[model samples]
Target: MGDAATPLADTRRWLERAVIGLNLCPFAKSVHVKGQVHYALSEAQDAQEVLEDFTRELEALVALPAPERDTTLLVIPRGMEDFLGFNDLVARAERIVRKRRLEGVIQVASFHPRFVFAGEAEDDVTNYSNRAPYPTLHLLREESMDRAVAAFPDAAAIYEVNMETLRRLGLEGWTALDVGPHA
Candidate 1:
């Protein structure tokens, strides 16, 4: 497996490239519609601090004027939360969005680590034949992207995955469940 530190960054860069390459023209119209990364807090004490930072950054981003009429806000979550905590956060965010009148603009996405192998053939060729097993890299699902994009109509969502890992998996269109952008 690749070093943890660089993998995430590398994944993010690849995602940026993929989005650009897709040429989803509508998303490109608004300056406010951009990707963001967030890490989950490890402790209750850290929540406030994390929230404060998020709020500040979000406020600043929202304040900026967009050349287009539509704007999309993407929120990426980094940690696990109990059902209660998750509901609470969602409720609070909903309230905040309503209060700010930002519905249909702001989108929240949660990402967890996942292993993606290249399709069976590649795995057989590389991992089976090689002395060492092939590495499984973290990947986000297209379902997660769909959910995020649906929540925020003006936004597009994507999960971060290692390109190398995907190449190894040999996954093709429809193999990964609707690989294209959400309609």
Candidate 2:
């Protein structure tokens, strides 16, 4: 998080070792291999700046077809480190999506260094699935998502499957991947 490239490097590693390697995101590998994933590290120091930058990225995604740019990783290297604040920022981000009339066309997914599920304990291993090297706003295309889900067998079970995978990996195994916390 300190260096300029740290976020991207850590993020790429997380994708490689955790997301893709563990098969957490079945669709990620294909886009990644095709060089369609856009990773943009934002240098914004506050939420406002991050929001502006996020809007720009969202627009950028809209400009390109799904094949050229499937999704975007707007990684904020600063601000919103606290999960509560980060969650609030995510809400604002969604508002922007709706404001831009991209509600059904684009959606925002969240990833944070300290992501936690509503009912899960802070140390729950399941949260690691949403943890990223930095606070990232994942801008996804609705149509692409629908296509991916339609093709994925039992798409509704992804969450349950991911939870089970993390449960088996445990805290030690997650730490071994060097992606995030053990607690």
Candidate 3:
């Protein structure tokens, strides 16, 4: 892959620029890449349901794109242990993607509530409801972030592309693309 540092920096820079250009708040979160399972436990019934829905959506995402399937997925769990469902979902996704011989990549991660931001503009965090925009931004654990940087230094740039693509399409941009059907 490209230099790890380059991609990581690119992702971070892209996110930073997007936040500014889109008038989005910082959201106080760090992004990273790694191979691990993350789960969140929540008491809210809605949170639990949304977590399941997120997993299904994630599975379908990885299955899309027929050729040159290089893609990264950011998975946000409902709560701790919610990753259990995520793991199952990933297995199913792997089967589908592999069966189609799609050239893509899938990376799963989770975000803490602290990393989420809500508001109409970038500076405000008022409207921040984790459920609306996305269930989670999925963070790479502290240790994993370090390793991900080591492995894919250029992840930052790649991540920028992801954020830019999202912005261009607008919120729920993936839905507009009909990557599958909206959850």
Candidate 4:
């Protein structure tokens, strides 16, 4: 989906063409339109450095008000290419959230190029729902999430609906979007 030189550009396109365009995350479009999404690129060369960067970004998000920064996408364009390693990093990130006593205040959601759900096959089209052009940590405010969920009816079915959408889109349609790791 993106090379080292243009992770932010690629990420923005994925947000526009896939996440928002396909309605993968129903709440994304509003914040995006408001310019409340923060995109940060980290050049950390290892897991520890990535965690440090994550901590900084986490603090940064909390330091700001919700109207100014509703969410953050910490894009790691280096040293986190392996999905398993990236998954481990995500665990560490959650620990940081707890360590800072922000468990309910903020939450971490992960996305990776090779994101595979539990029991799902590596090539399953469903995995694409969480797949992104790069390893990313999505930091969200719990209050904002709660409000959004409250406003959207049948929010519990978003995942099932996304699966149906992707199933209909198929591999060719996803390829047409050109937003996956291989794009």
Q: Please write out the lDDT profile of model 2 over residues 1-183, one tens digit for every residue.
A: 356877887788888999999889988898899998999988998999999999999999999998999999998877878999999899999999999999999989999988999998999999998998789999999998899899999988888899999999999999899874222
Displacement of the residue 112 alpha carbon in candidate 1, Å: 3.6
Off by over 4 Å in 2: 180-183
Q: Candidate 3 at 50: error in angstroms?
A: 16
Q: Please, what are the lDDT tens digits per residue for candidate 4 over residues 1-183?
A: 356548887888899999999999999999999999999989888999999999999999999999999999999977898999998999999999999999999999999988998998998899999998989999999999999999999899999999999999988998899885443
lDDT of 1 by residue, 1-183 (tens): 233334334333333443333332223322223433231222222335434544554455456443222232222233322323443554554555557665555544322222113454432322211111111111122343455457665552222222333345443521342222221
- Compute the lDDT of residue 18 as modeled in candidate 1: 34
Clashing pairs in 4: 1-181
CA-lDDT, candidates in order? 0.34, 0.90, 0.36, 0.92
Residue-wise lDDT of candidate 3 within 1-183, one digit each (tens)?
A: 233233233334333344333433222223312222222322223444544554555455445442222223233322433434534544554454455453234333432223334334542233222212223333222333445456764655654554454556564642332221122
Clashes of 4: 1
Question: Lowest lDDT 10-mer window, candidate 4?
Answer: 1-10
Runs off by more than 4 Å, candidate 1? 1-11, 17-45, 67-91, 114-183
Question: Which of the two candidates, 1 or 4, achieves a greater TM-score against the reference?
Answer: 4
Model 1 compared with the native: what TM-score? 0.36
RMSD of 1: 12.1
- Please give each candidate's TM-score: 0.36, 0.95, 0.29, 0.95
